[model samples]
Target: MYNALMGTAATTAVGAGLTLYYLEKNSAHANMEAEGLHPADYPFPQKKLFGTFDHASIRRGFQVFKEVCSACHSLDLVHWRNLVDVAYTEDEVREMAEEFEYTDGPDDKGEMFERPGKLTDPIPRPYANEEAARAANAGALPPDLSLITKARHGGVDYIYALLTGYCDPPAGVEVREGLNYNPYFPGGAIAMAQNIFDGVVEYEDGTPNTASQIAKDVVTFLNWAAEPELDDRKKIGAKALLLFSSLTLMALWIKRNRWHTLKSRKIAFNSPKNWNKKPNPPSKN
Candidate 1:
């Protein structure tokens, strides 16, 4: 009984909370639902050459990661093995794997093994643990970059947008207390300052070391991280669905043609069963 009451109360609380949130954001929510103005609705802007992923661009992004963000943030979910899917060669991946240090010890035979990193090794944290990370980043632990493209409101597009959106606060916009001035952040300010800046990292790609380029390339790399096989997955899914749909349609057509006969036969068979199963008027009592 107590569990039932608790469940009821929890459901009521959730309903009430949702009601309040909806009331507060009714206009935005309505606009998003009706027009798909939500984060995932934003389309990735792609051109023939500049927008799409390539080796030079991803390599440049790696350079950016190494020079800037990798000091604090860690992409714990992404393994070095996955880099091959993102256009890295096996040798390049091996070379990259050597950069990260991993922990391993002797086996039962007491033979030492070099267990720094491998193709299958997940990205390790820069800090020892969450407590250490929080202590360094002013109480905000840096999020893993592996799933960042999908986790954010606009996915890769949002990261691209946010990176390029850094600008001066608009005129007449009241700067809220405890908030530094920013126009692009969803909440007008973030603890993280302008991350992408010009001439920050020297790219081996020979592209100009502009903040905009870095931001765009990094976002592209992140998109790759989130869904490396998205195109292949989508293609396979489409083909499978088409086959299933065709089979279903054929089955439906056959069923439609045979429905009357099947129904008649079922009725004929069911009558005897019903008659035999009947109570026989309770033995005429």
Candidate 2:
């Protein structure tokens, strides 16, 4: 009895302690009701159920990423070869890959060497490591944007808002030093300042290089980066849907037309009434 009572008391104490700890953590995190604003529901044409990414926008987004975001953020998951025929041609990717030198293996003399970046190599990192990245960015690590669209809650829309939402903090809002105000971000302060602006990048397609346009294109590119096979996936999904629908209809028709009689027919069982007496009568006849 004592052991059971002690166990019960211990469990209750642990539960109470956990509850208190969670409550304190929640209070710390939920200081303000305004955690962040919902991202704008911009009607991206490529986000359509059966739609594809805009390749032109993807190219522009690549341009934006290279010229702007690449300075701090690294696209570690992507390879130079992956961009070929998706955003840029093979020749272009080859040329772009050649622009960055990569560290190669030691020679016969046991010396490391530098070689041009190959298409197969992962995209160059901005910093050598996390420590260096943090040191450069005032101890704030710039996140790799390879899968950022899928990693975040609101996906690309959230990113777009974040990119364009930087502004002066409202009254009573105190953004600390080294932080910038963006209502779209949780806690309303982010390490990444407003990077996009009007004419920040010149679009080869002649799209006006407004801040919003830049944000949109980059967001699109990030989304594509997150899911490079989106177009192929959509195509496969449509084909699969059609195939399954046809199979389902065919199955229903076969059940209705071919197996209709077998499925619908009812069997009646008759009890032998005069069998015993009939056998005796037949023998007499």
Candidate 3:
């Protein structure tokens, strides 16, 4: 009876496994055949152990964001002063801030008025509020980009893919009127359209501004914005590790030195035969 029950259980398990295998195979085939969806090539920046931001790329990315993405996305966590020596010089940052007018005071007249932005001011938003932003973008709210690179699954690669992934829907797939097809996006449809193109922004450093280059640079900038203190953190960690390692070596040396006598000491034991040699004592008696 037990043998029969075991056979029944094995048969059921094999059937279930076959069913799952076929289902997974069919799903993979469907994904491969789907239009406008393809696995993105991983970016080089993520491959290194001590991967650092490409500052020039980051600067170009900031330009793209400032000119294009700022129309939709808000970078609320970033401050003008934070740009100093990172993306822009202090003088350049100040000048950039002066271009935007921010609502400053409700002073003597108890009414608010616009004033030129200062170094301490946050980046200005295109919309006054979330409602306004949504209304402008046909009810789709653009996400804040402060931590976007870290928030998404593939990090920089995802952003770069999404930016460059726009394409026509496959023959069998039906794309809704407003939604665009992007294979890299989870649902294979995205609300945001392709924003980057060749010569979208001229680089001051003479780097060719291709579509891929723009996407990569903007992604780099966003990554930096997501973690501005990355360089400092790495530096501090490296220093701490060095100090700890040096101290550990010193401690090991001290320990070995302290135990040297005990480790090197030798002892000799006399045999019982030697103890029996009491002739000198007997002669004295």
What are the per-residue Cα lDDT tens digits for candidate 3 across 205-247? 8999999888888888999999898877877878899999999
Instruction: Compare the candidates by lDDT and give the number of the best one.
Output: 2
Which residue window of length 10 is worst by lDDT in model 3?
32-41
In terms of lDDT, model 1 sits at 0.70
Model 1 Cα lDDT, one tens digit per residue, 1-285: 999999999999999999998765443643332232233223444322223455567767767876787888887777888777466788989888888777767877887666768788876678999999989877777787888987975576667666666566667656554344444355566556667899988876579999978987787677777766665666687789999999999889888887858766743334565665756465645
Candidate 1: worst 10 consecutive residues by lDDT? 33-42
List the candidates' TM-scores in order.
Answer: 0.61, 0.82, 0.78
Residue pairs in steric clash, candidate 2? none
- Clash pairs detected, candidate 3: 37-183
User: RMSD, each candidate, Å?
Assistant: 11.5, 9.9, 8.3
Mind sharing the TM-score for model 3? 0.78
Name model 2 segments beyond 4 Å from true: 1-34, 266-285
lDDT of each: 0.70, 0.89, 0.84
Candidate 3 regions off by >4 Å?
1-41, 263-285
Root-mean-square deviation of Cα positions for candidate 1 versus the true structure, in angstroms: 11.5
